[model samples]
Target: MWNTRFRLIFISSSTYSALGLLPMRPCSSSDPKPGCCPPSPALKTGAWHSHCARSASPAELCRFRSLGPGTSGDTGSAAIESVQGAKNVDIIVLLPKGHCTKIQELQMTTVLRENVHVFGVEGNSDELDEPIKTVFADVAFVKKHNLMSLNSINWSRVLVQIAHHFFAYFRCAPSLDMHPLPPVEVVVPTGAAGNLAAGCIAQKMGLPIHLVVAVNSNDIIHRTVQWGDFSLSKAVKPTLASAMDIQVPYNMERIFWLLSGSDSQVIRALMEQFERTKSVSLPKELHSKLSEAVTSQSVSDEAITQTMGRCWQENQYLLCPHSAVAVSCHYQQVDRQQPSPPRCCLAPASAAKFPEAVRAARLTLDTPAEILALEHKEARCTPMRKGDDWTRMLRDTIEDLSQQWQRRFLNLPA
Candidate 1:
């Protein structure tokens, strides 16, 4: 696994290009440039997990925290395991109660680490982010506590995800010898638009990629791409692909900034409008640019099930609902006899994480023995009820943890 010494810095539009953290040019040749890029932390580390804590002094307590709406359970589970036994680091994850599948919830709540804090919030995943954002907004508090967020809002997460597009391009490209590398189609099943934003960045860096944004019933991203209607629906629809059930794809602003030639002013104005009205018609010119950069489709619950069953029947490979959403787009392309480049469907979760989806597909569940054992483990999670001031609670928790660390460091009573 790759580890970097740098701490998480919230990237802004003006500074992202200047940071030069990623490549600006496309691949020079087809031979799959050996070490063209470093392995992304998401793959080497864990979902939304950062190595910032590793750089802390022995006596200092570094906190790596995240807010997750708990779609598939992978992010919380991975984040928890990444710092399971680290003495100087703690991970605090907030997951929406009853929103995730039982297995997904168990995977996180069953962890018995002293430094791991999992909260079952009585709200949607999107609602959980508000309090975390509020806490992180406090510059002094964050600096004093050595706090870092391993969420999509953090640039590192997006930076790591960029590697996926490059790897997929190299794997699927038919030839490297041509003057320009052969284009490949990347089908992304996304929510919050983090991975989609990464793909857009990859394309900007000269990767010859056609991005197909795949979504389930929550089709705001699809609608925006297809019709330039950047507006939220009445409500987020629950689907088999629960993780992709997002009304607002927040990362679209990043994509807009990149595609608009890093025009931060225009993006800021547009986003301000969106925030104020919960809807905005994209400028004709920007909408045109977005359409050229990516195609989109919204898969239905029925299609997710059919695609899952079809994959199992044809290839003996079970797919999670989220993955099936992307595959469903691919199937549509083939069924219509559309000419397309080599396509790679990004599967962001495992079928084992969602036995309910597997059952919906009429496929035998293939959960591992270790995963099956989670149910019997002692489970624990703090509840954030409807009337609670979640933001204040989060602040209090962080302060409490910091105080506890200080007490232990001084050999004082708990």
Candidate 2:
């Protein structure tokens, strides 16, 4: 049997490039080649359109462009990029708006202006929580929009754009800071978009991190990962884990792309098929590739509820419903006699965000009032719309801002 702990084998950028993975290279006077985009002929269907459909040769990918204030020599930018490329950069948390409650967390960290764009969406946690003005130059254009309306294509494009922009900001270099990079063992709490984004970003950056997509009872992602079939069943059943009550995960397009050996034509065809019939199965070879790096599991709403109370009772820590899903998955592994490496589950919200869910779980555990006081804390965020025509709006915003940023990026003062 394999050791219970996760043993990470780090691969150099040049080796990854040789293996047809990524074109990343260490920052130096030499050009840092970019990963290739498939030829236009290979992207004739599915979400491929506009700039994404065009072929980007290796040279074109290598061009260093600018979007804002940063040069390859910038210490802050170097710290950020090197952190991503380093073997020690382990678990990634796509923070749920206010991952950092205090402003002190921003010390010496490079916060991109585009991050504020993420906060502007109404009911977006970052709107109330993120220390925006302190980080970005402009937060005016970032507005609240319906998140549910984001379709596969829109999500794919947004994630790709964000990942590329973030990674390419500074040429890859060794960090000047003291933060040692940690190897990524598993990325937990698979809530569709975040998990897929983590996977896509890891692939793009050429990091060898296994993805663990933890899900609540809405188990499409779990099922897809386990069965190699991407499909939608009936409508998603609402539960205490409201944030993860999703039947169809749009970011699966990115996962499908990676699973299919980065063959644009194959991914385009699969996505088109899914759009039509609500199901698509990976080819045998592709399925094998996916199994190498990705695994998923489902935790029921009851398990989430129970886990929340158990955390409060046993560990004296309150867990939000979504976080409970991840905890439940971890324990489930133990129950099945399977070993899990050291893992970190992302907590998307404060326990106070879901007072009712917390109260219900804590009451069952008969917890004291003082600990549960987190429930009554004043929260400034509003409710997000369950559904809306948000796709076009987000696309427009990302495209316009990206264009402006690209110009700024290309015309940097050298």
Candidate 3:
């Protein structure tokens, strides 16, 4: 499932001002042409690639090595580019359901390339390896079709990608005074096991991290973390905070890698925590430090709605569903602590994405402009149950659309 704890930051902006908050890394300024800020060369893995409108059929166009990532970059981080001609490469996405309700499943099935293969992982509902098995079956189906998954299991990517940000965030902090920041604990609300996977990596790197979680009354984050397992609890639905709706821990392999260590090293260090005690499945006695664990404290949906209203009224900031929860936790944590560590709450999506929720919160509409545009009442999605499969829906739409693909590669070469 997801970790309720979050990465702490030291910034002076209000919740509405997340954009203005200092960035973790600045885009290299003044590049001659675009192709410069590339991902690691190793990522290419030596496959075909292009932006040309070659291969008229979706099936014929999926052999390329690189994928057209619909990377909705934060404001100035990376301009959205359209991958005009990149077609169906196999994809394994971990997300909640109902995320792509705005678009049809067939469209996603057909949009990329004929080889455009897609599999959705039910991370939001926290379904465990069942979703992974479903994805594997899809991969098997696609294998006969000449398409294969980039990452059928999410934990591998979690191990690698998560390492960068946790390290990068502390490195970028001008305030941390750079004390090797190991044992530098990070707590995120686990809606999916992704954040916890990241924390496990940071911990392995010798950083003392307290992986905290927050969930509504029926959430499974506590069950997963406490039992070291995943639960398919149908009772839990989306609360006011939509993103923290996951019930399965997708990246469990990574967690085991940390826990199965010879030392209870992780648990030994973290056992001092109150309601959430730590236990290192690792059995060795090598020098270790425990980053404590913090359990969740729920906020009323009324509180969240009101919090959104108050933030806009008091600070002129727009808080989407997920960010609002972070703000709530932040304010509470600040009041509880004598002095809070500089905290940074990562908003994975834009507030504009959820209009009904925003309207429900009674915030005035802002002009819609691409992702920047938030006023498309017609295109707005309504989740079936709260947090049902929203992320999957989102990943499906993001992967299947011709327009979204185009936006990802807008400035890049053919």
Candidate 4:
């Protein structure tokens, strides 16, 4: 049986941070007080911030899974660390059992925190989102619990990510003195297409950027861009870049919405049709706009390993598998002698988090000692087996925690 604790907090809308509805506070023992952290420069401009948090109840609900090697670890660590020692804040994370690499799993499960609840489900990352969506669909339940997602599905995630494009452009741009800013090409290793959507939004907002969508064996995004085939593959092919091994790129809908001039009706119809049939051909106009806005390429497992090895040999920089996916596209363009703008390949994770990928690349593993220590730590997470009603399990867990919290609030015994 899993031992659970409900040390939780209710964050009001005005206090939500750019990362998600979850409020960000400075993490330090000395400053244990809870308050709104300073806003980023992007938020300071009053452009990307959304009021989605304001419409929700006070309790924060974050859904997390191992998207890739470093991504899940980073996300899980940040989520746990942010609410450390905070009262009335509980985070329930659902990760795909046996899908994530050992290091990735341990990075999340090893944290023996009372407020953090981690569950291992027998499914892929996309499948984990199903129960979360179902739970969030109950408006009354959501309000009663004050729930808000912290994943890429949240508008706040995309809004915060919009800053990445700006930062990359400013760093890569040659001069700001020109009549129009010089265009920079951003190669994003995409799975859920959140960052790619952010780049598109940035482009729409007059940023001079050419976005490149890069992917591994699971190449739905590549197919969507290269062809008008907005369809799922028969199955998701697991790759060294485990995060990009998603057949469904949900954020592509946002791109379509943006490119189609925000025609909500068309977007809604198309998405609904897709939800029903698991396939849809992009409209000619939308396809044309998508092609113009973004170019994409799909890398293979071989390519990922090759890029990782080549990067280590040439620059002594070991890239995580997901990063190598984007770098592979950069290498292809260079190899083909194609004329291109100043390029920045977004490397979202460290190689240290992907020892399996590093070993597969035939390179020496150079993981930090701290990361190595995770293997020895005691870890715990409830397993959601094949026959289990995951949604019911999730709801039961949330309900139990809420009841426990309520009881404690009223000075009742546990």
Question: Considering summed lDDT, which 10 consecutive residues are worst modelled in model 4?
Answer: 1-10
Per-residue accuracy of model 4 over 136-181 as CA lDDT, tens digit each: 7888988777566666777777886787778777766667898888
Local distance difference test values of all predictions, in order: 0.72, 0.43, 0.40, 0.69
Per-residue accuracy of model 1 over 117-233 as CA lDDT, tens digit each: 888898876778778878888999888776777667777778977876777677566679988787888888888898899999999899999999999888889999999999988
What are the per-residue Cα lDDT tens digits for candidate 2 across 317-359?
Answer: 6666776776676555545655433333444433544556766
Q: Order of all candidates by lDDT, from best down to worst?
A: 1, 4, 2, 3
Ranked candidates (TM-score, high to low): 1, 4, 3, 2
Name the candidate, 1 or 4, with the larger TM-score value. 1
1 against 2, candidate with superior lDDT:
1
Error of 3 at 358 (Å): 1.2
- Model 1 TM-score (2 dp): 0.86
Over 41-79, each residue of candidate 3 has an lDDT whose tens digit, in order, gives 222111111222232465554333223211111110111
Which residue ranges in model 3 land beyond 4 Å of their true spot? Answer: 1-84, 87-132, 135-152, 171-185, 216-218, 223-234, 262-300, 371-414
Model 1, CA-based lDDT = 0.72
Which of candidates 1 and 4 reaches a greater lDDT?
1
Top-TM-score structure, candidate number: 1
| Whole-structure CA lDDT of model 2 | 0.43
